[model samples]
Target: MVKSNDSMKKNNILSKVLIGAAVIVGMIIFTIYQYNTAKAWSNRIYPGVKIENQDLSGKTKGEAKSIIEKKYKVGIIKKKLNIKTDARNYTLDFSKINPKYDIDGAINQAFNYGKDRNLLKKYQLIKLSSTKKFDLKLVYDDKPVNEFIDSIEKEVNKAPVDATLNISQGNIKVVPEKKGETLQKDKLKKELSSKINGEIDHDIDIKAPMQAVNAKITGDKISSINYKIGEFSTEYGSISSPERENNIVLATKSINGKILMPGDIFSFNDIVGERTAERGYEAAPIIVGDKVDSGLGGGICQVSSTLYNAVIRANIKSVERTHHSLPSHYVKLGMDATVDYGNLDYKFKNTLKYPIYIEGDASGGVVLFNVYSNNSLAGTVTELSSNVYQTVEPNIKYQDDATLPEGKTEVEKPFSTGYKVKVTKTTTQDGKLISRETITDDYYEPVEGIIKRGIKKPETTPVIPPAVPAATPPTPSAQPSTTPSAPKN
Candidate 1:
């Protein structure tokens, strides 16, 4: 029984040894197979490795990069992206953006697919790559793309246009406003990126995104001015100088066709700008420091005065107004509004609910201003009047003149009477008085009469006694009888 048991044990041990040797032989064969496979693919991509779905199997790093360049980089350079807009279509070439692929990175990844793993893991991955397919990442610079999009934006964007009014003679025309359009840059960029990164085998078409822009001043807002609310006219016939008349005409033209919305303040200085020779303003008569002198933009004050009266009649509020140092010849004593650039400005605000328009005309010795507004103010009437409260007599001034003969006199400047006056504005509707308000109390300075009297003495003529005959010797003896008889004293 013991020998039989030992025999069974010996046979079992021999069976175990044979099984262990077979296992060792199988491991050695598997290691040799793995090593051979890894060595074969040491410089080549795996069978299932791809870049953007383009198979790079069995290709070396240089060969893989060449394949990707021919398939993607070359194709990208030849491909174009069509951008559609409302106005037109723009085509952008991929070459402009200098498209590039990460050829090195993709090739390295494919080549190193199974290199970092153990024999079993490497075999499993090498086998799995056939069906699992490893894909490489794509990288490119987006700066050029952004620059192209910016150019597109500049070409597509438009500024909105506001409505305006044009008045000629008595006719009025309304120019309609126009809406604008802007490109949607962010949305367009995303769309382009998606398409550019997805494929490059064919030309692309992308619709540029856009948004609408609204105009600020619509036609309806400017059409509210349909009636003449107030008007005033001043005669420039007394101003004989052509330069002064030219200045008046230029200034009136500057103020013509001006529109003022509710609560808008109109600045005479801002509208007329600085009066200079470059602006076509001639030297004319202007009031400077209590003296009338020739200066640039001299006669524009008449236009300002005329417009001021019209504004007052329209019931508009004056924000800034100044009176001349001396009474103006065209307007009443207290009704003039004088403006000097950078120093004095005549400003008024539109107080009505609707917009107002100013129409000015200076022609044929007449300077006129017409204020137009809503038709609701048609029946309203405004009357302006000035009352003189005190009159100041001018003093006479004498000056010596050496050029004139003695007792001669010449008037340098004529005397002008000064007055303190009160200006009042009266408003009435349908012959019924609505309101009466005192506008201003102004005082005009008196101008002294300058008279030049002659201080030079007159030239005297020399008076000569009749030529006395040369004393001759007494006629002989007649003179010789000297010491005759002396008359009794």
Candidate 2:
């Protein structure tokens, strides 16, 4: 009985050991299969976008790497998404369909590829999701880049891809704008205000430049700009800018259509145009860039300067004026330049209620300014003599080494005679001269010099065969003339 029992136990132990070994082998094979499936799944890829135009979905992860590795290091394209692309729509249809690539067990692993690229920084594909939107923003130079961002957001939350009517400065014109098509004034103002910074909130520049002098001698108040005030147009054509001229007429306009009262200051430049030939002004000399230069309008200064002096002579306050670098020969040197343009100008207060008339004309090489005012005593002015001094001439100079050949350089400028003169301006209302002022002017010397140069000549010397002293005359005595030698004396 004991032996039998022992035999049964041995048998049982052997069976248990066999079963345990089988289980271990099965587990090992299953683990290996699982690992391979996972690896395959990781390699799987869905249709992915290329940087430029490469399709990523067709390639497995390893294939993705293999394809890019050989193409080009510099141009390796990766799929991505971002806010700036202005994407219309996109999607990965992996819901009902199986993954194109047979990578391991993960069903939709193909769609996750190229997630590490820089282009993906701004966006993420919702696992198995699709979307449509207005194009994403791809670039920005300033922050909160779009000025209308907030306003747009307020009106519509969703991206709006189709909308017209926004016009930039390039498309705007002076013509009347259409309703709904034109930018809203309030909105434009708001937009400009938002874009600009600082005390004066505005986007475009409103600053004007200094161009021509203004002249307003009429005694009546200017009531309108575009309105007809008496015979002349209150609303003149227009001046382009302070630096340039506008091809239009200039009118005496009121501020915001306000009329001027007696004793009120009339600003000329603020309402009228500057002097320019295109605007019907005769060609005259003018100061450009504050420099003395001859331009289309050569004689306008005489008019302005004349008016300046006339007003001063009448004991009136002067508003705007400019003096010449060199004194003028016409209309006395001390005063000049009075013009009637739409904007750039000069103005004075009409102190007297009684009207005054400004009369000026160009005759010969002269501009005469006369002010007609109602007064019991006619004011007259005479300019006294002012000190005059001679101008110094510039020293002559050689242009250059090339311009002047070596040893041939001469004075490029020349020394010459100089000159000076003084002009006295006289103002008269009726028969008497009430005021007088003298202006002195100087002119630098002028010259017409010439240049000359000298060149060295080669030396010439006689090359007589180096001197061989003339052979001493052959001794005549020794040879003997057939006559017997006389002896040794």
Candidate 3:
């Protein structure tokens, strides 16, 4: 019985050893399979991985990126986004906005899908990757989109036109005002974003929203302005050159027939625009520092000065005004207003209860500015006067001239006396004083008289008298006794 038990024990030991060996072999096989599978997919995306419906199974990172680019990036560049506006239709290419996709990041994510998981989890993930999908985020520059919207806005937007009055002789002609329209940019941008950021398989179509804009000055609001409230004229024909006159006419016409509503500010620079040669402004005299220089749109300052006086006489509030370095001949010392584009501007606000119409004319040697309003204020009179408080004598400036002869002098520029003047404006109704206000206290710089004197000496030639011929004398021996000797005194 003991021998039989030993044999059974040995058999049991062998059975147990065989079972252990089989289990070890099975684990080795499983580990080898897992390692082989992992190595095969090391350089490629696992099977069944996709980016936005585009399958990337068994594809390398580079291959996946190419597929995504072909499907999305290239497609986006070829697609057109159509924008419909109330006025017209606009088409924009998606490439202009620089559309792009995160293909590289998506590919990396796909490649690393099952890399960080445990053995069992990795296996399960690899198995289920056929059903799993990833998204490639779309990106683009918004600046181009905003710029496109801005361009569309400019084309779709319309400015409201104010009613204008044209006065010829005594007849008045009225031009009706027109309402304007503006684009709804915010709403349009939101609508555009939804489509641009979505699937780009087809062309996009969007409708731009719009809103109506009412005119500020309607026809009826300006039709009652018929009476001339204030008028001022400056003589430019006598002092202006042909180019200067042209500038004055152009500037006057720019402000002609303009209407200013109550509380509205008039900007001379905004109305005249830039003084460029392309805008038909000619080279004329303009004040630069203390000297007069030739520049484009030179004589427009006279137009501004004339308009200033008219505005003051109409009781309009001056918002911005600057005096010239030297007193202008066209206007009084303290009454002149100078304007330089981008540097100085002449602005005024309408302070009356009704609209005021400015009628300007630079014809027949005169630049006249007329302010018209309701006839009820016709009896209201305003007078502007200037008083010189101090005077400054100009200094003489001598300049040498080599062209002129010695001791010769010539006056290049005449002396101009500077004055500190105070301007006052008095308002009266029916001979009763309403208000007397000081308009401005201005100081004009003294301009030195320039005299050019000759520093070069004159060239002179030496004069030589002609030599008289020596008299021919008779032979001394033959004529010695011919004449009697004279007594010595």
Best by TM-score: 3
- For every model shown, the clashing-pair count is 0, 48, 0
Off by over 4 Å in 1: 1-32, 46-55, 67-83, 90-125, 130-178, 183-206, 219-225, 233-305, 320-330, 333-347, 360-368, 386-422, 441-489
**Model 3 lowest lDDT segment of ten:** 123-132
Q: Please, what is the whole-model Cα lDDT of each candidate in the order they appear?
A: 0.85, 0.38, 0.88
Ranking by lDDT: 3, 1, 2
RMSD of each: 7.8, 22.9, 8.3
* Selected candidate, larger lDDT, 1 vs 2: 1
Quantify how close model 3 is to the true structure by its C-alpha RMSD in Å: 8.3
The candidate with the higher lDDT, 1 or 3, is 3
For candidate 1, the per-residue lDDT at 439 reads 88
lDDT for each residue of candidate 3 in 1-489, tens digit (9 for 90 to 100)? 357888999999999999999999988998788777777777888787778788888888888888888888778788888889866899988888788887787788887887887776666556565556888777888898888889999998999987788788878778898988999999998898777766667798898888889988888988889899998999999898999999999999999988888888999999989999999999999998788899999999999999999989987769999999988999988999999999999999888998889999999999999999998898899999999999999999999999988789999987778899999999999889999989899989788899999989878999999999999986667545757889999
Residue pairs with colliding backbones in model 1 are none
Give candidate 2 regions above 4 Å deviation: 1-272, 276-278, 281-298, 313-317, 338-345, 351-353, 363-366, 379-384, 389-489
lDDT of 1 by residue, 1-489 (tens): 357988999999999999998999988997899888877777777777777778877888888888877787667678887899878898877777777766677667777877787777766666666633444444666787788789889998998987767776767788899999998898998898778766676788999999999987788998887778889999986765889898999999999878888889999999999999999999998999778889999899989999999999988879999999988878888999999999999999888999988888888889999999888898889998999999999998999999988899999987788899999988899899999998899988798899999989988999998886877785666546557888897
For this target, which candidate reaches the highest lDDT against the unseen true structure? 3
Ranking by TM-score: 3, 1, 2
User: How well is each residue in 364-426 modelled by candidate 2, as lDDT tens digits?
Assistant: 323344444434424333333444465445344434344334566554333453445454655
